[model samples]
Target: MGGTNDAADGTYALRAVDPLIGELLAGLPALLLVGPRAVGKTTTAHRFARSELRLDYPPTAQAVAVDPDAVLRELDEPVLIDEWQVAPAVLGAVKRAVDQAPHPGRFLVTGSVRGDLDSPTWPGTGRLVRVNMYGLTVAELLGRAPREPFLDRVAAQGVEHLPTPLERPDLRGYVELALRSGFPEAALELPADLRERWLDSYLDQLLTRDLAMIGGQRDPDRVRRYLEALALHTAGVVEHQAVFRAADLSRATADAYDHLLRNLLVAEAVPAWHSSRLKRLVRTPKRYLIEPALVASVLRLDTNSILQDALLLGRLLDTFVMAQLRAELPLCRSRPRLFHLRQADGRREIDLIAELSGRRTVAIEVKAGAPGTGDARHLAWLRDELGDEFVGGVILHTGQLAYSLGDRLTAAPISTLWA
Candidate 1:
């Protein structure tokens, strides 16, 4: 992360070194990089391979679609196949090639969408090791390191090593950071108007092209409306019927749309943390957009509106924290799974939860304003209820200090996500 250039231009930010990528490339025959569009999958894959075939190009797509084997036969070198989803047959070719002649690092496949059931490729299973990615994290964008991965830290010890800071992100500072686009092509460096236009175009492409590719006689206009409605519901637990009604989509159609978004990693379903230890834990998972800026783009909310709208700000602050934890979880040593916890009656709730092996779980409560002792009440309750299974709890706020609230409960600033 110290270097200004990542393999070349400064546009490529130094994403945290993912040991999974290294290990997969060394032992696996194919590595599939899956995520939403413009997530830097192609850019990251380019770093390791000399030979490449861009299936996104019309000519290449046609070639692979027509005869995937010939395309693979032509690539004798370790090859990078960009937008492999465009020609699902290429996946089959890669699988066949791997089986015919076993070799590590023979193929690097990048996809903007999830695997197509109709694709000619077999499940690959042991053949294709998948690595999920997202838009550049705040740490990567700033070219800095996170102060401490609170998720892993809390999982290891119960608030024993909570970082202390005299200053952190205040209210205004939090909004400013969230407003910055996580997409590298149109990040904070760009003017506000330009970034907005870029985001608009990105949505246009998704609705116009990618959505249709998922099947069904999908109407882009309807899908656009559905996505807009979905944006309004982001960062909260939603009933499928409510979502379908808002989007004017049938239940079956909504299921297909949900699958597509989930495949793209655009809509993260934060599963509700269930524990037999508790009396009653909600089973509904909260819906979250991949990045906070996407919320602004979809809802057409400007910076001024975002700042003035308290309700929107609160939901987005929660979504942004989810984005950060999701990005960091894979990089953490514990590799915990992120979840949400709430009572059916809404008596208690934790905005974010990270669960590791052996019932060890770290709970987080996101507050857009300064957090006080009361903010830690839910965390304290969870700790007491779960006992040793509860790794610890934290109140992540827009405050300026990191301090302990009580036993196994601490208050830390949101900015600590990317120190």
Candidate 2:
């Protein structure tokens, strides 16, 4: 039960860890980095740009809104515009600027919220490129992203040579990680009480400001209830009707709220992976909170409380694993689309199915504890079903060892996600 979120000073520079995005920044004319607030998008973007306009600050946003062209012309090249969505008009200005002079490394935009759907601003569809930045992965947070390249190996070699050893945390350690969170500022010694207050305010702003900024609305109480309802279903496939029922809201309303959460990147929905022959698989997607700490906080679970609840702990651990995969996938040279799979008849389920390029697939089953071959039955079944199309399979657990489970299968420590 002892840990803190304080990150090293060097983390402020995104390039220090997230080289994938750094490399992209060099090539892309403009990069719009989107993520939930306090994940360090602004902090990282500032490290590269000569000047920044924080649109979340009212006067700065209004100045840009008054004359976006003037603001665009005045800012230096590779200008950083944090919270560009606050002034949607700036997008068109940026697009026009790009069209006039089609050069690489022109602008760096960072947004914690999106713009209104009905807003008149053009999205700069072809001219601007958008990439998401998530909370630090354990690997990036610990400064091992460059030195430890296992995820790349998983993508390229498919469990060939083994990965290096990793720290295997006990149950308490796992829960501590969840509490410490991946949010950059939160990771940096944000006190426990303040973290709670920050979450409370974050959710409030989402309902009152972020949603309205995007031409949306929801009952604050109802949305909270819906989130609580959704928390119970995290890491598993559940129907929309079920979520609506649990939240006591209309189907349309629940659907709308769900879409907003997705747009904000707070809720990550993993679609069911299927093939033409796998029509029997359930088509419903599994939705999880984008960060494990959010799941615990939404459910009001602390260390002691979570340790007492094995079932919830297991589900949260699955969310933890999937969230890490989501963050780690983009860093890979061959980025794969993440999905979840379940048989319609409920006979088997695979926690994660990553569809990589060339029709190759990487299947991962998340387990809270160390896994046995018996625990890998579903993973093996998937391997047999996919045959050669299956690049590899692994039972990712909170254990230290990374060993073969035979037939291109490996029992990998979950830490391999970022280590």
TM-score to native of every candidate shown: 0.91, 0.92
TM-score of 2: 0.92
Return the number of clashes found in candidate 2: 4
Model 1 TM-score, 2 decimals:
0.91
Which candidate ranks first by lDDT, i.e. highest?
Answer: 1
Tens digit of per-residue lDDT, candidate 1, span 205-290:
77767776665467778777777767888888777788889988899988887877776568868888888878677898888888
- On residues 203-223, what C-alpha lDDT tens digit does candidate 2 reach at each position? 677666766665455576777
lDDT of each: 0.76, 0.75
Question: What's the CA error at residue 12 for candidate 1, in Å?
Answer: 3.0
Error of 2 at 50 (Å): 1.0
